[model samples]
Structure formats: C-alpha cells, structure tokens
Target: MPYPLLHAKAALDELKLAARSAPGIMVGVTIATTALANVPGMGDAKANWNSLAKALEVEYPNLIGNAVFLSRAGWIADDREAFLNAASVFSGDLQKLSGLCYTMEGQVDQVRDAYALYWMEIGLLAATVLGYLLACQAMKLTPHLRAAGEILLARLTLLTNAMIAQKTKVLYGFLAVAGGTLATSSQSLGQLFNIQPTESAAINFERAVIPTDPPSVYLAPKRELPARPKQQQR
Candidate 1:
C-alpha cells in the first residue's frame, strides 16, 4: 500500500536503532509486504509477521531483528535502487580487483585462495542482481493481476539475506587479501628507500543477516495470477 521507498526507509531506520544499541550484534530481520494487510477473509499476514517479530525481538534480545512489512519492502526498493545506480560499476571493480589480486598471489596456496575468493565474490554479486530483478518484477504487480507480487518479494527476501551473508564472508576475505597486498607493496616500496613498512590494520566485522517470515505469512489466501486480457471479437 505504501510507496516501496517509504517502506524501505522505515526498515533501515529500525536497523539503525538496533545497531546503535547493540553495535556488536548482527541481526537477521524479516518483513512481509502485502496489499491485503487490512483485507478480511484473506489472511492477515502482515499482523502475524509483526507479532512474530515482536516475539523474536523479546526472546532473542539483540540477536533477532524485527522482520516486518516495512523492512521487506524497504530492502527490495533499496537493493533495486542500488542495482540501478552502481551495479555495473561495482561489478567492473570486482573484476578488476580480483584480477589484480590474483596476479599478486605468488604461492600455490595464495593462488588457490585468491581464485576461490574471487569466484565466490562474482557468484554472490550475480545472485544479488538476479534477486533484485525478481523483486522488481514482483513489485510491479497491480490489482488487475491476481498473483500477489508480495509473495514473490517475500521469497526473494530470503535469497537476498543469504546473499548478504555470503557477501560478508567475501568481504572479510577481501580485507585480508587487500591488507596483505598493501603490505607487500609497501614492503617493496620501503625496501627501495631503506624504510620500514607500516603494519596494516586488522579487519574484523560480523556478517549481517536479514531473514523474513515465510510466503504464506505475506501472500493472501485464494490468490491467483491475473489472466492476460482477452482480445474482443471485431
């Protein structure tokens, strides 16, 4: 019912609140998006998700983030915007950086590690793009269409969370590899000038997870995809 962006902003605001208090905790929040929030006879999926989130928030303390409609819509819109603006640039950067890192890796172990790291990075990025596109298609559904796009969006939310978790792992690998590369480059530069290389800062960050409720919680009962418009006989 709400503009996808507004829903997305609310979700981010919630996460920011959680982050401020429990800076160390990484929450896997989930949210459901449905136009049928107030519809009767059909399932009241949104309310159920809110209740679940509240329960989890209380039970898990800082471990569980609230996964409600706002957050789910917010994530989808935000990711779509990101892909629109920087997906191409980011993809290029990853390719270039991965190639550079691979060249720098000398030992067999280093080569293997770099290969695995880059492979996963590229794979995850591709997955992220595909997920975003799916979300886009789902969000475009109108009342004229019987199928609920929110249901598809709900499923994509789970996939997106998984991609985020994988990205975190790849990010940690990048920091380590980049740090070593910088250190190696620094040492080479320092040796030429008879100066010592500075120590690189250790990079450590917890992976963020944003999980959501199941599709049934977001989809309406008796929902069917909208049929194609039939041509009138002339």
Candidate 2:
C-alpha cells in the first residue's frame, strides 16, 4: 500500500474510534452535569455541558463523516510524497481530536466534593477548571477540522491535475500512433494505385509535432528540390 493510503487509513481509524467513544463521553458529561446541578449556582457548568454534548452528538460526527469522504476520494495519490505529507498532518489532527474525548472523560471524573467548609467554592473552582479545559479543546478541535479539510483539498487538487496531465499524454501518444499508421497505409495504397496522396493541416499537425519533445528535433527536415530545368524556347 502507498504511504498516503496508510496515513489516510490511520486517520479514518482514529476518527472511527473517536466516534465510537463519544457516547461514553456523553454519559460521563451527563453525570458531571448532574453532580454540578446538585450544587447551588452551577448553571454556567450545565450550559457548558449542553454545548459540549451538542458537539459530541452532532458537530463532531458530521466533521468525521466529511473527513471520511474526503479521505476516500483522495485515495488515488498521483503525487505520492505530497499526498503522504498532507495525510500525515491530517492523521495527527485526527489523533488530537480522538484524544479530546478521553481527556474530557478524565476531567469529568474529577468532579468530587472537596469536603471542606468552602466546599461550594471548591466545586465552583472545579467547574471553572473543567469549563476552561473544554473551551480550549473546542477551540483546538475547530482548527484541526479545518486543517484536515484544507489538506484533503490541496492533495485532491494535486492528484486531479496530475491525472489530467497523464491522460493527456496518453491521448496524444495514441493519436500519434494512429496518425502514423493511417499515413503509412494511405501512402502504400496511393503508390499501389499510382496516385498522389493528399495532405491536410490536421494530419500534418498530428504527425509533425510531439508535445513531449523539443520542437526543433521533431520538425520535418526541409529538402532542397533539384534545380528546375531552364525554360526551353517556346
């Protein structure tokens, strides 16, 4: 398998793992929100939980689906090195995205009571910390998703352009071969019948120039005709 494909597969695997683990993260978030609601004046934490849940349930999955589609589309990497480089970056971004769910779960698990007289203060502080972490992760997530998209687009463009160039070369090669065969056959038939073969601009253009070679080398040689006989007295 090509390196680009390998990296793409790794990225897709990470995305799948993240998607599979999201429901578990959601459960942890729900528990954390429940605990926070039991304390007085933790509305902000609950709001944050709602936002995070929406991301996990809706936005994250949508992004993953897009990534999967792009990755599959970009599987035929004409520029292997460039594609591999882009795929590696995307793979790293995907790993970070997948790790977010685990990180969030860990943070949620740490919402225990401090059991001090300032327990309310401690709970609020914990909520603040968790909220801050969640916010940071959210910020990072958006950019990583955007980067993944850009990388895929760039590689796809490269692949597309390369394919077009290759196909054009092949088409030109086929035309050159067909034109030569036709010209040779026509000349042979013209000779057998003792007739002059006609030439056309299109056939001349097809036979004379090869796009891949230097024009000077492929141009037909100019032949000097025998000196015309001096005009006889009429």
lDDT scores of the candidates, listed in order? 0.43, 0.42
Clash pairs, model 2 backbone: none
Tell me the TM-score of each prediction against the true structure.
Answer: 0.24, 0.23
Per-residue error (Å), model 2, residue 207: 44
| Residue clash pairs of candidate 1 | 8-74, 28-209, 30-67, 30-211, 30-212, 31-67, 31-68, 146-226, 147-225
lDDT of 2 by residue, 41-154 (tens): 223343454466456556765676676557665443455556657656655554554445334333332221111112333234334434433443454468666565545434
Error of 1 at 87 (Å): 54
- Stretches of candidate 1 off by over 4 Å are 1-149, 195-234
lDDT digits (tens) for residues 180-224 of candidate 1 = 875875465345456444456433336545666666556445668
lDDT of 2: 0.42
TM-score of 2: 0.23
Window of ten residues with lowest summed lDDT in model 1: 32-41
